[model samples]
Target: IKYLFINHYCTLDNLFDILLYTPQLCRVNVKYLCQLHDIILNEIPIILSNLAHITIEELDLPFDVFEIFIKKMTSKLQVLSIGIISMNFTYLDVNQWEQLISQHIPYLSKFHFEHYEKMPSLSNDHHNLLKQFTTFFWIKQQWFFEIHIDTQLNGVLKKLSIPFIHIGHVLNSSILSSQGIQLVISSVDERDHDILLNDYIKSIIISTNITCLTINSSMISCVLIELLEILHNLDSLTISYSSRLLKLHGCSQQSKHHNLSTTMNITKVNMCYVTKIEQVDFILKFCPHIQYSVQMILNYHH
Candidate 1:
């Protein structure tokens, strides 16, 4: 089987037994239930050991289980998404993880991770755990095929992942390779504005191509505009605001596209609370050539 998706929680032992026979499977997505703690917490070692040699290239699993998988699994992964349960753990080993990535998973590039727990107050140790990722990427920067981070500003978890969070590229991804860089920041909060803004801009403003970008933020409009100005060849952009913060930058006369044109580079844009056509028209100015299928929020005068 080339792809397998399990929408419900299944016992790890039973899943392993099924995988053992499906040697041809290349990707698996199992929506594991947290209630199945026995499978994730207890049987991880055994589950990983049994599937050590499989060619599975992409996966989404609980954080701890995937941690074990990353260190032990022989298959080189390309894309990974992990639901982190806690940043407050005292025993998270960073050095071991660094060594594992450097040695075993050298081909891994794209990653998506977000905290699932309710606790947002990360202590110094939690920040350190997060730092491990920064360190790993920094070390592997020269070898990365391309880098991207897209963070969707969701409340509760003050996390950063988008473009880079939802998507990434390793030199050895099991799926189709992404050829360029991208950065997305959406739904960001003021609490994370200071440090994250400084850090992310400094890190990503390198000499590379950001082919696709999205900025659905108002608090960081100035920062986003400065970032857009720096990019030499941004192919597409999808930006929105709860209000008219960006649209007030005003629409451009130079941006002209046919309503039926289909060759633009921007992906789909989601806009709400838009009460005017000038607002949508102003957003389209970012990538005048973009052609998406979505009917941009049409606030026609009745």
Candidate 2:
């Protein structure tokens, strides 16, 4: 297989065994890479010379264990994206990361790294952690960083459990040094979508630099209007559309107050969790210039 995607939990041994068969795999995306139980390392390395892209959504394995897996690749991987829910800050060690890339994946051209943890649990050493990423190594690679902390604002922000959001790619380097920004909002309960999104947008240093965005939060008309007003440069958007989208059926009080005269320059729109056709119609009204579109309807009761 040239491409493989694993969404469920997978142990290291299970992954190794699977890789053993897919020697010609060029790309692999694992949603969650976890260590269910301890397993002995394979004496023989499984070479994936053709594999050039690797994206691990959640790295549940420790740094050392993951290092072993990287070494086994023995290939010049061109793209590597990793998201980690770190228990130990060892993953923040810039020296180890530099050395690993230098020795193992020397030809790696693109590297996307994300670290997730409860911000409140962090000690004063959080500054030190942030400083490590600002080193010459990261700066030279144009990997600038931003830390999102969940805060209480008029009792709105406090409702969020995991408020991290990965605001996707930066289209213009001149606008922001960072090539991409990912805001991960890890939450268990339903978030106050409008207020939370507004608060998150306010935290951004340069919101205009963010050309593409994915809103996993529950969709609402006020939130959509707020996004249109604030994100003036947004070119593409991905959002959920359900019964809440029906809220925009008529000119609501919020829509009446806001000026909808400014036409959005957005060219692409992707909708998920769509429950009705009217939801699509509502979006089209706001984004008149959408050149490309995609919608996913999970359950069609309409």
Candidate 3:
């Protein structure tokens, strides 16, 4: 029965008992996955105890329903992945979310939550609860991960010691300056002028243990220089920018002089852009030690 579901209707809940006990079942589709989750919540206590990793997509269930399921099944769960149709969070608050996470999912090592458009707003008390969770649980854990949040969540994140990856608006300057951060991959829409004007970039450079950095093209030159100086132990760096912006900044002389003489430890540098090949060449010239390669790619005409 487990083999049948493993090979055929793996998404359905009919084989969940078999699957849960099988020890080898690691992956399941979202539609049938929830059914199995419901089964585990209702029937067997030890069914989900062996699950090492679980991922569910297209979940439209209420937050309370999901919280109950998590509290029941995630005692030994090490890796958790959830995908909602979109982040129109109307039914959950920070307290409820924090309570669910704290009571259940105590042993989780890796967690992934995806929100489509917007995240739910937590009250001040809930935010404080989140801060407590970050300090007590997230920081103490061996591995912790979260995605999708605006600058405001940085306050909570500052207390966490785990390496994290954030994919949203630039974090607050104070948050970037917090201690124990080791990696940052920022995906910012360059057209958003407000972020470029923000002081967070300088904060990132002056503080933190950031060793790996990736940024969009519109990152200001002053901030980039500051980052290069402060991230003396950086190993991998990627920078993406638009062609028109590259032209405005000029490529030739700037590229030749762009090397971080102090950051000899950097091993990889990836420069991605649309328009000016010269700018790419210039970046290559600056980082003479970095292996350079380029390919012609179509531009986004807008």
Candidate 4:
């Protein structure tokens, strides 16, 4: 069968029987596999050698248990997500993992190893390893994926899926020189996004090549208007009044339109959350190409 779901815990005997009888099984979750067979540590390698040949495509296992197959070869295994509950990955230096990747799991494309502990910093070895790979990202506390730049980077960010996608693309010169380059951070976790906006966004934009931004924040309001107004290319804005937006009853009028639109600048304005209908009329007064509707709130809606 293509799927196998074991509702109860499995012991050593059950795993051996699975290897012998379930040759057709393509997926197996031994999350509850728990305690290993007391088959003496000397004999564990023999069982591990046999287990390595199984044609499984995905695996879920404890971090300590997976250390057995770190440098071992496995065929057809493409995806792996394991817990770092009881292990310290910093000890496994990047070169060690490079040997594992280049020699062992050559077919692996998507990998997520999560931990609940405080995040660790990437050492010099980490930077050396990342420079050789085509694409890889760090999943920060399961909130979002970040692909940051280092002094040794080549400024080529691949289009891939991951948490808090920290990206920088080289336009005219190297990415370091691309001043208006933008880092588009998107996520369903609004709380994490807000935290990123408050803490990390400023430092990142100031130190790196990030200017234009297209994002959705559930925490936007009048208190942050002056903050957002300074963004380089502020296009496609989303404002939700459900979070207590200051009403227009006691708002000041525009001394002059100042023409917020330019010939080749931030011209396209999308006014979403039509709580006040007059907002659309005000935009038409100074800006054209007005986009409305709840669906338009999404950057990819067009």
Estimate, for each residue in 1-302, the C-alpha lDDT of model 4 and write its tens digit. 44566655665445555544544545545544544544323233222222222222223344344445443222455555443333343423445554565566656555544332221233334334323222232211111222332211122322311233223222222111122343333332323333344433444344432333443333333323323434544433334333323244314334323324331133344444545555444434443433433232322222
TM-score of each candidate structure, all chains considered together: 0.43, 0.55, 0.44, 0.40
In candidate 3, which residue ranges exceed 4 Å CA deviation? 1-27, 31-46, 72-75, 85-102, 118-133, 142-213, 218-302
Colliding pairs, model 3? 11-32, 217-240, 217-241
Model 2, position 97: C-alpha lDDT score: 88
RMSD of each: 10.4, 8.9, 10.7, 11.8
lDDT of each: 0.46, 0.62, 0.45, 0.37
What residue runs in model 4 are displaced by over 4 Å at the alpha carbon? 6-23, 30-65, 70-74, 83-93, 112-144, 147-216, 221-302
Report the alpha-carbon TM-score of model 1 versus the true structure.
Answer: 0.43
Model 1 Cα shift for residue 185 (angstroms): 6.1
Model 1 Cα lDDT, one tens digit per residue, 115-176: 43322343344434433443444334432223333233344444653222322333442211
Error of 4 at 180 (Å): 16
Error of 1 at 231 (Å): 20
Candidate 1, lDDT over the whole model: 0.46
**Which candidate number has the best TM-score?**
2
